[model samples]
Target: MVGYARGVSRVLVSAVLVAAALLLAGCGSDAPPVSRPSSLPIPDGFTRVGGLSNGLVMAIPSSWRSVDLSKTDFEKELEASGLTGATLEQAKTSLRSLQKSKALYAMDPASQQESPDGFVTNLNGFCQPSVGASADALIEIAKQQLTSVNAKVSEAASVPLGQGTAVRIRYTLPLGKALINGTQYYVPSDKGRTCVVTLSTDLTGKNALFDQIGGTIRPV
Candidate 1:
Protein backbone atom coordinates (compact mmCIF):
# COMPACT_ATOMS: atom_id res chain seq x y z
CA MET A 1 0.00 0.00 0.00
CA VAL A 2 2.85 2.36 0.78
CA GLY A 3 4.29 1.67 -2.62
CA TYR A 4 0.93 2.41 -4.18
CA ALA A 5 0.68 5.67 -2.25
CA ARG A 6 4.08 6.82 -3.41
CA GLY A 7 3.33 5.81 -6.94
CA VAL A 8 0.11 7.81 -6.90
CA SER A 9 1.87 10.82 -5.44
CA ARG A 10 4.50 10.80 -8.14
CA VAL A 11 1.84 10.52 -10.80
CA LEU A 12 -0.17 13.39 -9.36
CA VAL A 13 2.82 15.69 -9.08
CA SER A 14 4.15 14.80 -12.50
CA ALA A 15 0.78 15.28 -14.11
CA VAL A 16 0.32 18.68 -12.53
CA LEU A 17 3.76 19.83 -13.62
CA VAL A 18 3.14 18.59 -17.13
CA ALA A 19 -0.07 20.54 -17.30
CA ALA A 20 1.63 23.60 -15.85
CA ALA A 21 4.45 23.35 -18.32
CA LEU A 22 1.98 23.49 -21.14
CA LEU A 23 0.30 26.53 -19.68
CA LEU A 24 3.57 28.27 -19.01
CA ALA A 25 4.89 27.49 -22.41
CA GLY A 26 1.95 29.36 -23.86
CA CYS A 27 2.42 32.41 -21.70
CA GLY A 28 4.97 35.17 -22.26
CA SER A 29 6.91 37.57 -20.06
CA ASP A 30 8.21 41.13 -20.51
CA ALA A 31 11.03 40.33 -22.89
CA PRO A 32 11.83 40.84 -26.55
CA PRO A 33 10.64 38.07 -28.84
CA VAL A 34 13.10 35.73 -30.51
CA SER A 35 12.65 34.76 -34.13
CA ARG A 36 11.70 31.17 -34.95
CA PRO A 37 10.92 29.16 -38.07
CA SER A 38 7.48 29.80 -39.50
CA SER A 39 7.01 26.12 -40.24
CA LEU A 40 6.50 25.30 -36.56
CA PRO A 41 2.91 24.44 -35.65
CA ILE A 42 2.92 26.74 -32.64
CA PRO A 43 2.01 30.30 -33.47
CA ASP A 44 4.85 32.81 -33.72
CA GLY A 45 4.08 34.32 -30.31
CA PHE A 46 2.71 31.33 -28.40
CA THR A 47 4.41 28.17 -27.16
CA ARG A 48 2.53 24.87 -27.33
CA VAL A 49 3.24 21.82 -25.21
CA GLY A 50 1.58 18.85 -23.49
CA GLY A 51 -1.46 16.91 -24.69
CA LEU A 52 -3.77 14.07 -23.63
CA SER A 53 -5.22 10.88 -25.07
CA ASN A 54 -7.53 8.07 -23.84
CA GLY A 55 -10.73 10.08 -23.93
CA LEU A 56 -9.08 13.19 -22.49
CA VAL A 57 -7.79 16.22 -24.39
CA MET A 58 -5.66 19.20 -23.26
CA ALA A 59 -2.93 21.42 -24.71
CA ILE A 60 -0.57 23.82 -22.98
CA PRO A 61 2.22 26.24 -23.85
CA SER A 62 5.54 25.03 -25.25
CA SER A 63 7.81 27.02 -22.94
CA TRP A 64 7.40 24.81 -19.89
CA ARG A 65 9.36 21.58 -19.56
CA SER A 66 7.22 18.52 -19.08
CA VAL A 67 8.40 16.23 -16.33
CA ASP A 68 9.70 12.95 -17.71
CA LEU A 69 8.65 10.00 -15.57
CA SER A 70 11.08 7.76 -17.46
CA LYS A 71 14.05 9.36 -15.73
CA THR A 72 16.08 7.07 -13.48
CA ASP A 73 15.58 9.25 -10.39
CA PHE A 74 11.85 9.20 -10.85
CA GLU A 75 11.99 5.43 -11.27
CA LYS A 76 13.99 5.13 -8.08
CA GLU A 77 11.34 7.06 -6.18
CA LEU A 78 8.66 4.73 -7.49
CA GLU A 79 10.72 1.72 -6.51
CA ALA A 80 11.29 3.12 -3.00
CA SER A 81 7.55 3.06 -2.47
CA GLY A 82 7.80 -0.60 -1.47
CA LEU A 83 7.07 -1.63 -5.00
CA THR A 84 10.43 -3.26 -5.51
CA GLY A 85 8.67 -6.06 -7.35
CA ALA A 86 7.10 -3.56 -9.67
CA THR A 87 9.21 -2.42 -12.59
CA LEU A 88 9.54 1.25 -13.54
CA GLU A 89 7.71 0.46 -16.75
CA GLN A 90 4.83 -0.90 -14.71
CA ALA A 91 4.74 2.23 -12.58
CA LYS A 92 4.56 4.46 -15.64
CA THR A 93 1.82 2.38 -17.20
CA SER A 94 -0.19 2.43 -13.98
CA LEU A 95 -0.17 6.24 -13.90
CA ARG A 96 -2.49 6.47 -16.88
CA SER A 97 -4.28 3.13 -16.45
CA LEU A 98 -8.00 3.48 -16.91
CA GLN A 99 -10.69 1.23 -15.44
CA LYS A 100 -13.93 0.45 -17.24
CA SER A 101 -15.89 -0.93 -14.31
CA LYS A 102 -16.98 2.40 -12.81
CA ALA A 103 -18.91 5.49 -13.85
CA LEU A 104 -18.93 9.16 -12.91
CA TYR A 105 -21.75 10.36 -10.76
CA ALA A 106 -24.33 12.63 -12.30
CA MET A 107 -23.34 16.29 -12.20
CA ASP A 108 -25.24 17.73 -9.28
CA PRO A 109 -24.58 21.43 -9.02
CA ALA A 110 -26.76 21.46 -5.92
CA SER A 111 -24.96 18.57 -4.27
CA GLN A 112 -23.03 20.69 -1.78
CA GLN A 113 -20.17 20.69 -4.25
CA GLU A 114 -18.92 24.18 -3.82
CA SER A 115 -16.15 25.56 -6.05
CA PRO A 116 -13.44 24.33 -3.76
CA ASP A 117 -13.26 26.96 -1.01
CA GLY A 118 -9.50 26.55 -1.31
CA PHE A 119 -7.33 24.49 -3.64
CA VAL A 120 -7.47 21.32 -1.51
CA THR A 121 -11.13 20.49 -1.34
CA ASN A 122 -12.48 16.95 -1.25
CA LEU A 123 -13.10 15.12 -4.55
CA ASN A 124 -14.31 11.85 -3.03
CA GLY A 125 -17.77 12.07 -4.56
CA PHE A 126 -16.57 13.16 -8.01
CA CYS A 127 -16.70 9.52 -9.05
CA GLN A 128 -17.41 6.12 -7.55
CA PRO A 129 -14.89 5.25 -4.83
CA SER A 130 -14.19 1.77 -6.17
CA VAL A 131 -10.68 2.87 -7.15
CA GLY A 132 -7.96 3.26 -4.55
CA ALA A 133 -8.84 5.66 -1.72
CA SER A 134 -5.35 7.06 -1.61
CA ALA A 135 -5.65 8.49 -5.11
CA ASP A 136 -8.84 10.33 -4.25
CA ALA A 137 -7.45 11.61 -0.96
CA LEU A 138 -4.30 12.94 -2.59
CA ILE A 139 -6.34 14.93 -5.10
CA GLU A 140 -8.18 16.69 -2.33
CA ILE A 141 -4.92 17.55 -0.67
CA ALA A 142 -3.38 18.85 -3.90
CA LYS A 143 -6.37 21.05 -4.62
CA GLN A 144 -6.14 22.64 -1.20
CA GLN A 145 -2.44 23.20 -1.55
CA LEU A 146 -2.81 24.74 -4.99
CA THR A 147 -5.63 26.99 -3.86
CA SER A 148 -3.50 28.17 -0.97
CA VAL A 149 -0.66 29.01 -3.29
CA ASN A 150 -2.67 30.79 -5.97
CA ALA A 151 -5.50 32.28 -3.87
CA LYS A 152 -8.06 32.46 -6.69
CA VAL A 153 -10.01 30.06 -8.84
CA SER A 154 -10.04 31.02 -12.53
CA GLU A 155 -12.38 28.25 -13.67
CA ALA A 156 -13.84 24.93 -12.52
CA ALA A 157 -15.75 22.48 -14.67
CA SER A 158 -16.55 18.81 -14.24
CA VAL A 159 -16.03 16.33 -17.06
CA PRO A 160 -16.09 12.56 -17.63
CA LEU A 161 -12.75 10.79 -17.70
CA GLY A 162 -12.47 7.20 -19.01
CA GLN A 163 -15.56 5.27 -20.11
CA GLY A 164 -17.89 6.79 -17.50
CA THR A 165 -16.52 5.66 -14.17
CA ALA A 166 -14.24 8.62 -13.48
CA VAL A 167 -14.51 12.42 -13.54
CA ARG A 168 -12.23 15.45 -13.68
CA ILE A 169 -12.01 19.04 -12.44
CA ARG A 170 -10.61 21.40 -15.04
CA TYR A 171 -9.69 24.85 -13.76
CA THR A 172 -7.21 27.70 -13.90
CA LEU A 173 -5.48 29.55 -11.12
CA PRO A 174 -5.73 33.30 -11.64
CA LEU A 175 -2.54 35.25 -12.10
CA GLY A 176 -1.29 36.47 -8.78
CA LYS A 177 0.50 39.76 -8.01
CA ALA A 178 3.50 38.10 -9.60
CA LEU A 179 1.62 37.83 -12.89
CA ILE A 180 1.72 34.04 -12.93
CA ASN A 181 -1.24 31.88 -14.00
CA GLY A 182 -1.77 28.28 -13.01
CA THR A 183 -4.01 25.90 -14.89
CA GLN A 184 -4.94 22.55 -13.39
CA TYR A 185 -6.77 19.34 -14.12
CA TYR A 186 -7.91 16.99 -11.39
CA VAL A 187 -8.86 13.71 -13.01
CA PRO A 188 -9.98 10.44 -11.47
CA SER A 189 -8.68 7.27 -13.09
CA ASP A 190 -11.07 4.72 -14.60
CA LYS A 191 -10.82 2.69 -11.43
CA GLY A 192 -12.13 5.75 -9.57
CA ARG A 193 -8.59 6.79 -8.75
CA THR A 194 -7.25 10.34 -9.07
CA CYS A 195 -4.58 12.03 -11.22
CA VAL A 196 -3.80 15.73 -11.37
CA VAL A 197 -2.11 18.10 -13.87
CA THR A 198 -1.21 21.74 -13.34
CA LEU A 199 0.47 24.52 -15.32
CA SER A 200 1.73 27.84 -13.98
CA THR A 201 2.64 30.79 -16.18
CA ASP A 202 3.33 34.49 -16.55
CA LEU A 203 0.63 35.61 -18.97
CA THR A 204 1.44 39.27 -18.76
CA GLY A 205 1.51 39.96 -22.50
CA LYS A 206 0.60 36.80 -24.38
CA ASN A 207 -3.07 36.42 -23.52
CA ALA A 208 -3.74 34.92 -26.94
CA LEU A 209 -1.89 31.77 -25.94
CA PHE A 210 -4.70 30.92 -23.58
CA ASP A 211 -7.26 31.49 -26.28
CA GLN A 212 -5.43 29.24 -28.73
CA ILE A 213 -4.67 26.41 -26.31
CA GLY A 214 -7.88 26.68 -24.27
CA GLY A 215 -10.02 25.09 -26.94
CA THR A 216 -8.07 21.87 -26.83
CA ILE A 217 -9.77 20.77 -23.59
CA ARG A 218 -12.79 18.49 -23.88
CA PRO A 219 -14.64 16.01 -21.68
CA VAL A 220 -13.96 12.36 -22.37
Candidate 2:
Protein backbone atom coordinates (compact mmCIF):
# COMPACT_ATOMS: atom_id res chain seq x y z
CA MET A 1 0.00 0.00 0.00
CA VAL A 2 1.11 3.62 -0.61
CA GLY A 3 0.51 6.61 1.60
CA TYR A 4 -1.43 9.74 0.53
CA ALA A 5 -1.97 13.22 1.97
CA ARG A 6 -3.88 16.39 1.19
CA GLY A 7 -3.78 19.94 2.51
CA VAL A 8 -5.13 23.42 1.84
CA SER A 9 -2.44 26.09 1.69
CA ARG A 10 -1.25 28.38 -1.01
CA VAL A 11 1.71 27.08 -3.00
CA LEU A 12 3.05 27.83 -6.47
CA VAL A 13 0.51 25.61 -8.21
CA SER A 14 1.31 27.21 -11.54
CA ALA A 15 5.02 26.55 -11.15
CA VAL A 16 4.41 23.00 -10.04
CA LEU A 17 2.08 22.46 -12.96
CA VAL A 18 4.68 23.79 -15.36
CA ALA A 19 7.38 21.60 -13.89
CA ALA A 20 5.17 18.55 -14.09
CA ALA A 21 4.29 19.31 -17.69
CA LEU A 22 7.90 19.73 -18.67
CA LEU A 23 8.81 16.47 -17.02
CA LEU A 24 5.96 14.66 -18.73
CA ALA A 25 7.08 15.92 -22.08
CA GLY A 26 10.60 14.60 -21.66
CA CYS A 27 9.92 12.47 -24.74
CA GLY A 28 8.20 14.64 -27.26
CA SER A 29 5.11 13.49 -29.18
CA ASP A 30 4.11 15.14 -32.42
CA ALA A 31 1.29 12.88 -33.54
CA PRO A 32 -2.18 14.23 -32.95
CA PRO A 33 -4.67 12.29 -30.92
CA VAL A 34 -6.65 9.82 -32.99
CA SER A 35 -9.49 9.72 -30.48
CA ARG A 36 -10.42 10.54 -26.92
CA PRO A 37 -11.96 8.27 -24.30
CA SER A 38 -15.66 9.02 -24.28
CA SER A 39 -16.00 7.74 -20.73
CA LEU A 40 -13.63 10.32 -19.34
CA PRO A 41 -13.73 14.06 -19.77
CA ILE A 42 -10.43 15.10 -21.21
CA PRO A 43 -9.37 18.45 -19.90
CA ASP A 44 -8.41 21.16 -22.32
CA GLY A 45 -5.03 20.36 -23.85
CA PHE A 46 -4.89 17.16 -21.82
CA THR A 47 -2.48 14.63 -23.30
CA ARG A 48 -2.17 10.95 -22.65
CA VAL A 49 0.80 10.03 -20.48
CA GLY A 50 2.12 6.69 -19.31
CA GLY A 51 4.84 5.51 -16.99
CA LEU A 52 7.84 4.54 -19.12
CA SER A 53 8.40 1.04 -17.71
CA ASN A 54 5.19 0.23 -15.82
CA GLY A 55 2.93 1.20 -18.69
CA LEU A 56 0.85 3.09 -16.15
CA VAL A 57 -1.45 5.35 -18.12
CA MET A 58 -2.99 8.74 -17.37
CA ALA A 59 -4.10 11.88 -19.10
CA ILE A 60 -2.38 15.09 -18.16
CA PRO A 61 -3.80 18.47 -19.02
CA SER A 62 -1.67 19.86 -21.83
CA SER A 63 -0.54 22.27 -19.16
CA TRP A 64 0.76 19.32 -17.17
CA ARG A 65 3.64 17.26 -18.53
CA SER A 66 5.09 13.84 -17.77
CA VAL A 67 8.47 13.86 -16.11
CA ASP A 68 11.08 11.21 -16.78
CA LEU A 69 12.34 10.00 -13.43
CA SER A 70 15.49 8.66 -15.03
CA LYS A 71 16.78 12.15 -15.78
CA THR A 72 16.20 13.60 -12.35
CA ASP A 73 18.64 13.84 -9.45
CA PHE A 74 16.54 11.18 -7.82
CA GLU A 75 17.97 8.70 -10.28
CA LYS A 76 21.43 9.59 -9.09
CA GLU A 77 20.47 8.96 -5.50
CA LEU A 78 19.13 5.51 -6.32
CA GLU A 79 22.47 4.62 -7.80
CA ALA A 80 24.27 5.98 -4.75
CA SER A 81 22.29 3.83 -2.32
CA GLY A 82 25.05 1.30 -2.84
CA LEU A 83 22.86 -1.69 -3.48
CA THR A 84 25.16 -4.68 -3.95
CA GLY A 85 25.41 -5.86 -7.56
CA ALA A 86 22.60 -3.54 -8.54
CA THR A 87 22.81 -1.70 -11.84
CA LEU A 88 20.38 0.54 -13.64
CA GLU A 89 19.36 -2.22 -16.00
CA GLN A 90 18.99 -4.83 -13.28
CA ALA A 91 16.93 -2.43 -11.19
CA LYS A 92 14.53 -1.92 -14.06
CA THR A 93 14.14 -5.69 -14.33
CA SER A 94 13.18 -5.82 -10.67
CA LEU A 95 10.66 -3.02 -11.14
CA ARG A 96 8.85 -4.99 -13.80
CA SER A 97 8.69 -7.93 -11.44
CA LEU A 98 7.01 -5.81 -8.75
CA GLN A 99 4.46 -4.44 -11.16
CA LYS A 100 3.50 -7.95 -12.20
CA SER A 101 3.13 -8.94 -8.57
CA LYS A 102 1.01 -5.92 -7.52
CA ALA A 103 2.27 -6.23 -3.98
CA LEU A 104 -0.03 -4.78 -1.27
CA TYR A 105 1.11 -2.48 1.54
CA ALA A 106 0.19 0.77 3.28
CA MET A 107 0.86 4.02 1.48
CA ASP A 108 0.80 6.44 4.39
CA PRO A 109 3.66 7.05 6.75
CA ALA A 110 3.55 5.40 10.16
CA SER A 111 3.15 8.77 11.85
CA GLN A 112 0.04 9.71 9.89
CA GLN A 113 -1.81 6.42 9.49
CA GLU A 114 -5.03 7.61 11.16
CA SER A 115 -6.35 9.96 8.47
CA PRO A 116 -8.16 8.33 5.56
CA ASP A 117 -9.91 10.91 3.42
CA GLY A 118 -7.84 10.49 0.24
CA PHE A 119 -6.94 7.64 -2.12
CA VAL A 120 -3.95 5.27 -1.84
CA THR A 121 -2.65 2.09 -3.43
CA ASN A 122 0.62 0.26 -4.09
CA LEU A 123 1.82 0.64 -7.65
CA ASN A 124 2.99 -2.75 -8.84
CA GLY A 125 6.64 -2.43 -10.01
CA PHE A 126 10.09 -1.45 -8.96
CA CYS A 127 11.76 1.81 -10.08
CA GLN A 128 14.93 1.69 -12.14
CA PRO A 129 17.54 4.41 -12.39
CA SER A 130 18.95 5.31 -15.76
CA VAL A 131 21.93 7.08 -14.20
CA GLY A 132 23.09 8.78 -11.00
CA ALA A 133 23.07 7.82 -7.30
CA SER A 134 21.07 5.53 -5.05
CA ALA A 135 17.29 5.73 -5.53
CA ASP A 136 16.37 5.05 -1.93
CA ALA A 137 18.48 7.92 -0.58
CA LEU A 138 17.05 10.21 -3.20
CA ILE A 139 13.56 9.34 -2.07
CA GLU A 140 14.43 10.07 1.52
CA ILE A 141 15.77 13.43 0.46
CA ALA A 142 12.62 14.02 -1.53
CA LYS A 143 10.47 13.24 1.50
CA GLN A 144 12.33 15.85 3.49
CA GLN A 145 11.96 18.41 0.73
CA LEU A 146 8.24 17.74 0.26
CA THR A 147 7.68 18.36 3.95
CA SER A 148 8.77 21.93 3.31
CA VAL A 149 6.14 22.20 0.63
CA ASN A 150 3.51 21.87 3.36
CA ALA A 151 3.05 18.19 2.54
CA LYS A 152 2.21 15.69 5.24
CA VAL A 153 2.43 11.93 5.31
CA SER A 154 -0.80 9.96 5.14
CA GLU A 155 0.60 6.44 5.23
CA ALA A 156 3.80 4.46 4.80
CA ALA A 157 4.39 0.78 4.23
CA SER A 158 7.14 -1.57 3.09
CA VAL A 159 7.04 -4.31 0.47
CA PRO A 160 9.68 -6.88 -0.41
CA LEU A 161 11.93 -6.27 -3.39
CA GLY A 162 14.80 -8.33 -4.76
CA GLN A 163 17.23 -7.61 -1.94
CA GLY A 164 15.56 -4.56 -0.49
CA THR A 165 12.13 -3.27 0.52
CA ALA A 166 9.75 -1.11 -1.44
CA VAL A 167 8.66 1.88 0.64
CA ARG A 168 5.42 3.66 -0.19
CA ILE A 169 4.47 7.07 1.20
CA ARG A 170 1.43 9.23 0.58
CA TYR A 171 1.77 12.96 1.04
CA THR A 172 -0.78 15.77 0.96
CA LEU A 173 0.06 18.79 -1.13
CA PRO A 174 -1.50 22.04 -0.06
CA LEU A 175 -2.38 24.59 -2.70
CA GLY A 176 -4.56 27.66 -2.42
CA LYS A 177 -5.44 26.56 1.09
CA ALA A 178 -6.86 23.33 -0.27
CA LEU A 179 -5.59 19.81 0.14
CA ILE A 180 -4.22 18.25 -3.00
CA ASN A 181 -3.53 14.52 -2.97
CA GLY A 182 -0.30 12.71 -3.91
CA THR A 183 1.40 9.32 -3.49
CA GLN A 184 5.00 8.14 -3.76
CA TYR A 185 6.58 4.71 -3.98
CA TYR A 186 10.23 3.80 -3.34
CA VAL A 187 11.32 0.27 -4.30
CA PRO A 188 14.87 -0.41 -3.14
CA SER A 189 17.13 -3.04 -4.68
CA ASP A 190 17.67 -6.53 -3.33
CA LYS A 191 20.46 -5.34 -1.10
CA GLY A 192 18.11 -2.84 0.54
CA ARG A 193 20.39 -0.13 -0.77
CA THR A 194 19.13 1.91 -3.70
CA CYS A 195 15.57 2.21 -4.91
CA VAL A 196 14.65 0.58 -8.15
CA VAL A 197 11.45 2.54 -8.63
CA THR A 198 10.90 5.84 -6.89
CA LEU A 199 7.56 7.20 -8.03
CA SER A 200 5.31 9.95 -6.72
CA THR A 201 2.43 11.91 -8.15
CA ASP A 202 -0.55 14.04 -7.29
CA LEU A 203 -3.93 12.38 -6.86
CA THR A 204 -5.98 14.33 -9.38
CA GLY A 205 -9.33 13.55 -7.83
CA LYS A 206 -10.06 11.16 -5.01
CA ASN A 207 -7.28 9.11 -6.53
CA ALA A 208 -9.21 8.89 -9.76
CA LEU A 209 -5.93 9.79 -11.40
CA PHE A 210 -4.17 6.99 -9.54
CA ASP A 211 -6.81 4.49 -10.63
CA GLN A 212 -6.45 5.72 -14.18
CA ILE A 213 -2.67 5.56 -14.03
CA GLY A 214 -2.59 2.22 -12.25
CA GLY A 215 -4.80 0.66 -14.90
CA THR A 216 -2.18 1.43 -17.54
CA ILE A 217 0.87 0.40 -15.51
CA ARG A 218 2.18 -2.98 -16.68
CA PRO A 219 5.51 -4.65 -16.07
CA VAL A 220 8.03 -3.72 -18.72
TM-score of each: 0.34, 0.33
| Residue-level error in angstroms, candidate 2, position 123 | 12
Q: Give the TM-score of candidate 1.
A: 0.34
Q: Which candidate is the best by lDDT?
A: 2
Error of 1 at 49 (Å): 9.0
- Show where candidate 2 strays beyond 4 Å: 1-139, 160-165, 187-219
lDDT of 2 by residue, 1-220 (tens): 1211111111122223322321211000111111122333344555654333332233443433233333323334334433224233343333332333222111212211222322112222233322233334444555666676666767654433222233445567654423445554443222212222223333344355443333222222
Give the lDDT of residue 48 in candidate 1. Answer: 37
Q: Count the backbone clashes (under 3 Å) in each candidate.
A: 24, 59
Model 1 CA lDDT for position 144: 64
Worst 10 contiguous positions by lDDT, candidate 1: 117-126
